[model samples]
Target: MTAKPPTPVRRFGSIVGTVLTYVAIWLGLVLLIAGVGIRWFWGRITVRDMMISLQNVDLPAGYTREWQGFYGIVVAPLVIVLILAACHAGHALRVRTRRLGAWDQRPRRQRRRTRALSLGLALILVVTGASVFSSSVGLADFVRASRSTMDIGDYYAAPEVTGSENQRNIVNIYLESGEQTLSDTNLFEKDPYAPLEEQTSDWQSIEDYQQYQGGGWTMAGLVSSQCGIPLKGTIAPWYGGGNTAPPDSIRTYLQGTTCLGDVFKQQGYKNVFMGGARAEFASKDTFLQDHGYDEVKDLDLWKNSGESEKDFRPDWGLSDQRLLDHAKDEIDRLHAESEKTGQPFNLSMLTLDTHEPATAYDYCPVDTESRLISVYQCSMEQVAGYVDYMKDKGYLDDTAVVIQGDHLKHMTSSDSFHEQLDRNDHRSIVNRVWVPGQENKRRLRPGIDQLSMYPTLLEAAGLDIRDHSAGLGVSAFTDAIPGGSAQALGPRGYRELVATDSKDFYTRAWDGEEVHG
Candidate 1:
């Protein structure tokens, strides 16, 4: 204004500043898109899950939904819409400026500034990309390094063509802290009260189709049993950092795509998830949906409902007995639906009553955590009662029962059994597949996983096995045992797969590798 020195240049300078701002914005957006995408797969997207997955991220007090869009479906459309709007606005502005005769007056200086801004943005992208792939963003490096798909159509792949000819309902009854030995017949061995048998029956000996000695408790060893994969994920303390994976757990670990549910769905069977929790990996919702499951009962929902607790109150809600009853009702409902739709029904039920913190009172005659075995006996009663109900309802014969434990109790945590009981050599994740009266005994050695549950069950359930790729899950019952895999005692081993929250742990795995792209 003061002398109007180079009016054209001044206008150009203003344009240049605006161009620089946009350039920076664009560069920032690109970095954000790339950087965030890398993190999403590496970590859980939940506001809290971020802390579990990323080493460098910290969640302060009361941070929720401050950011979103971890999944591609959510983020993609948003980005496209924003870009289109900006482009439209810019085109209109240019047209108006040209009509106003401002195009001719717009300065070369403005173009120069725009070019400079673009250059700066390019530099920032370079820096961000390098940092992202470097030790600073270890997640990208890990995912790129370990991601592997299944071996489909290969000779090693399980045959899917004739998997469902013979049908058996697999019931895996997991007794947490189950008594290690056969002494406490109450929990597992046998039931004695009315005109019943002797002291107790060695629960498993009488009928054995396929079974296993999975190492440790529910999660650690149980995952191995189901997948025939090594239990290599976050331990109790350290979660997903060093060298473990979940989606991998689903793919490489469980190799469970060929699992029971999928096969049934493929063969015109309805997939239904009836359980007592919003299970983390049950993929309950996703799996059922993918397989076209019609009815799903999530225990998580019931616990939070406004209904009276006492009426439906068991420790986890709707005791195993109640679940069986519910199952009967659901089966009837399903049959009605099936009659209409003419499709066979597949039901997957997860029992939570056997889980700890049961409504059992401490002073109650059965109130005893004396030894790990005693505690397990109590829980087994819960399971026994459920099984008895199934037997009574006559579903026992009609249904292919899979009576197996999900995991061992805390008594089986590592070798720390002494703390829970004075026993040694008793720690094992006991798993079994009950085929009503069929005798096809195949047990995974100790040190296996529950992730093996799906695929193994698929084979047992008369369904063709699909992709069991990199899954540590190979059916211990049928998978070729990798010698020295567990050296511990079973067909499997437990490796605590972790990502590094500590810079040291991250750098250790990274071996101080530098990135310069």
Candidate 2:
């Protein structure tokens, strides 16, 4: 007896089920690949950091490899789905052509077992994908940390600027991925910071300069050192709401908080910022403009300059060599104006050659076996040369220079120094300070982090801050810290405070409210 064909409704339901199954398979594969890829690229980044990076998605040209890898991962799932569809199509065609006799007439028990196994495989994929994805994005960690109710506002201290007797010109340089760990000859083959250290041998150095939580990136580092607070994003994952999304919607950056630039502006200093990367890359320009920078020069300015296109790096903008050369000219012009007008100026700049996926410039010789190390050496050499130029021009007599790392090197899988850095437990941010007419050098107070740099920088520039405190930090220039300040809380306690969720406190900060105890 011949069996009758299925009803139209039954055929339609069958088609829908097949389509849903393929969708599920593709989604599962995509989730798994993306989760694994994120881990491979950025190694267990915090959810706050991830959110900030996502909201400000202006990536530099140097991240070509990362972009290409992401595209491949996304397409992999589609390729897999297509192959599965082709296999199903071939099986259906064989059945329709009647090429196999008992293919569709297999035992009911065998068919049921096959269906059960396939369902089991699908379940495994979905579960594994969800697990990996959640872990990679720090979802579990965020949830755990949300339970704590530590408020930064409790320890916050508003900067009390009592005015300086003699305002000195300030030159602050933020080194990309600068860490003293790179100078540990015990870990690596040689010290990449040797040139920089030799140049600033007479400058005061800060020891045990810990990198606090939330200050592990460039923007975060900038905020922490200048504003004396961790850079928190608007997302309140604990509440499952975006109540404080000002960073995305508003042009003002931390309008409620007082930063180095703001203080310098009040002091009648002409604040200027220059960098090799685009100022708009991470809304850096917005932050500087809002905070009180008079002039901001970046990749756009360099592109418009009459320099050869070959002078620029394809990934980031200009090479450190070119950036420092331009910086010399800027300082000369600024200094001349300051001398004539008797007005002190602030010049801040960030270097780019030491950024990840670093490349060697033609002007710099390859002294080390690793290209990354050579790049580091070359970049440091250029910065050191710039310092020498400042010294030659007699700017050091009336200037305060602060040279520090923006943050520790990100130990992603693509980074070259992870093998050495991962093993060392005593890693710290590299920093050097130069104050005008200082006869003796004093060690910075122990157990202080980037927060202390806020007051420290102000003091270096001849400003007198009350209690040597600003925001949550106490100036490293003094041994005494206020009783309730964040520095007095110690590094361990400070980390715990910053790790927890402080939505209300941060909301006030973003809203430009004066938050203080």
Candidate 3:
């Protein structure tokens, strides 16, 4: 007897169910791939951070190279879909052949083959679903921790610089993705930072400072250095779903936070921030403006100044050479204004040539195969030249210059560069203070965290902050003295402390529990 065909309603239901199953499977595969890929590419970032940062950040124009790691991910879904379709087609073909009495007496091997294929398909679907669910739970937990953390309100209290007598001008240079390890010849065949080491021998170096336990990105490093507090994703998006845009602006992210910029402003110092990248990107402008900076400038300013895109690279705004040139002009302008108004100035700039995944900028020297190494060499040259220019113009007469890397090298593909360095050695960010008068001063301690730079900058400007600490930080210089808390937390201890405290601290911080409190 021949079987009757299903009704129209039943047929429609079957098609809809099949379509929904395919869609669900595809969605699960994507979630699994994204979660795993993010962890692999950016190991230092938390899932919450990846969510929050991407909300306001766009991949740079030349970031295609960075996505090379994910080529497998792109092909994975198609492969899965094809396998599923092939299995279904094979089963349908076998059934149709049997119904036509052509395969009614199927061999035992064929029956076993069909059974194994069914099991394998079921296993794949089960594993994919489980992986997606697991990663989704992890992401949810991270968000919960972020939102339930203590409030950060009043964590960064304003320092009392009311009775300040000597206030020198400040010049801060933030080198992107720089590290002191570049100076170690063991890390590279040729010493990339030899020139920087030779020229800045008189500068104080803090080899012990830890970075990225609290925050890992550029803005995080900047906020940590200035406010002595790590930049964490405490604010959640207003949308109900994951990775949605936050209802509030980034400026309000740290509404009640105070930093060195605010302190400098209170002391009648003119604050200026300049960088080679866009000021608006990553909400850096908002952070700077919130901290009371004036005259914020970046690539937008450079472009508006009549410099065409002919000189600009799409990877990351302008080259370090152009940034330093513009910075010199800004410094000269600030100097003249300071002289006129009798107000000290704080001119801060972030260099971009060294940002990764490494690109070949104009400043990079010929014959260097590694763009990472070439950028470091270019950075040293630009910095040394800029220092000489400042000295020639007498800008250093009463100015304290702070030079530090925004964060440690972030490119995972730069494993070739790090292959020569000792495997056990802790990768460190660069922090050097060049106080005009105390040029010979150096910190002998093991290392310091980024937080210490806050008080160190204030100290370089001749502020006595010993009585009142710079938030959770101790001056790397002052802490070098015997018996200081920061001095006691040797490199190993500091690393352990950050690792132990970061999760709990960040959780409470997001919940509005002030660190100081």
Candidate 4:
């Protein structure tokens, strides 16, 4: 029997040879492709392309050519190689399993080759795709002006919280996709998101403030509007997020890292930081804390429980209604403190009820058609409802409601929106301020951003500490409120304002610490 076994050792030399050859080919191909893509993408060439990324950041003409070339050659390629290697290793292991082993000898060298091939292919696909996609994202598309036309130093502030008031109560509401059209026919009235006007018709009195176009995304517009973080340089989701450090914001200096919230907190005002979305998303909490918030409210604590995905609502975790459910409780707490100290309160509500990808809330009219309009109206009405709720609680009269959009949605700018609504438009921020009673009646202002809203509220309420300088768009109700033309200062002015703001902030938050804070 032993001698008979020597007669046959499974003669499959041809099969083994063929598989090994193919494995080698794929391995080489994957590596070649991945290496090429990594080098090209990682270069980060700042060669001035007219195309501006969402943050209006582009490889400036004469930027760092060496760095760009480095990415194309070293950094990105290395990352790509690693990613591809992982994928290929998995594939190589899979190919050497019992089934494939019948055809090949499962040689260690051959297995290694096949794994590298699979991994390289995966790396090439990922890096190449990201590079290509980043080139065309909506943020990069809308910016038409070259960097030369914009001045970063004008609006530039160093890394510090910019302050404007001593005890101004600031409330910024970021509407999901609030786009205002020529006829007031918003695009949020459809399947995904509903309009706020439909639910809270009381806002019908003031609809002119919600503007559209210019900068489309939130990081671009909201960042610029709120903190004077221009839509000019370095777009975000930046690789390092400009390092979430205090004294880095574009607000003011007297309080340094201290914003309107810090200003009020110092003035004995309660800083209530509330948001309907993830509280910790995008270091918003860090920014708030540096600016002087004692407690940043997490609107969706329910989502944190050790529960399955099924527990979440169609809108992810909670609806605007659910958040509204607790609005009274939050407000009551604020009121209790206000009563105790006779000190004013600062309420910053960063709402996400109007968030897109899920149009869970009812539109203002209840008859939805355009998704952009519908969702915005729903959120706006929620804004209105919040006011009413406050009115019933007697807090509405004193509270300065700042309602604005986080940024516009990309889906709304696609060809589908053009065909559906017969329009080509970008989502604008819902940057309107609502102040009840006689004080605001004489000067009802228009739209603004989270950054600007903070300072503007402080100003309107007569709460100034350090002088704010880098603001592009003035307070909606600034002393010289634009009474006629709503023509906002162009992108050039905005860029100038943002670029120069942060230095002043740091000058106050840190450099000026001995003099101010």
For candidate 2, list the clashing residue pairs, or say none: 256-512
Residues 404-508 of candidate 1: C-alpha lDDT, one tens digit per residue: 544444321122233323332343333444444443454433333454455555555545444422233344345554332222223211221211122322222
The per-candidate count of clashes, in order, stands at: 65, 1, 13, 84
Question: Highest lDDT: which candidate?
Answer: 2
TM-score of 4: 0.54
Worst 10 residues of 4 by lDDT: 43-52
Highest-scoring model, TM-score? 2
What TM-score, over all chains together, does every model reach? Answer: 0.47, 0.74, 0.67, 0.54
Candidate 3 residue-wise lDDT, 1-517, digit = tens = 3334546885686466555555556655766676566544443344544545545444345535334534545567657867886787797798877687343245545645755565556558657755654563354445443454333232333455544677688899998877777766655646666766677777777766677454556876887788876564432312313222223345344544458897888888889998888877767887788777988888888888888675577867877788888888888998998888899988999988777766565656645666678767877788878888988998878888888898877544333453443242567887667887654365434456777677778877767664345755666655334243433446544433333324444445434344442
Question: Candidate order by lDDT, highest to lowest?
Answer: 2, 3, 4, 1
Q: What's the true lDDT of residue 190 in model 2?
A: 83
Collision count of model 2: 1
Better of 1 and 4 by TM-score: 4
Off by over 4 Å in 3: 1-158, 236-253, 361-363, 412-424, 438-446, 466-468, 480-517
Q: What is candidate 4's lDDT per residue for 389-485, written digit by digit as tens?
A: 7667766556666565555443321212544333243324434455655555545444444334435555555454233322333444444533221
Report each candidate's C-alpha RMSD, comma-separated, in the order given: 17.3, 6.4, 7.3, 14.6
Give Cα-based local distance difference scores for all models. 0.43, 0.79, 0.65, 0.46
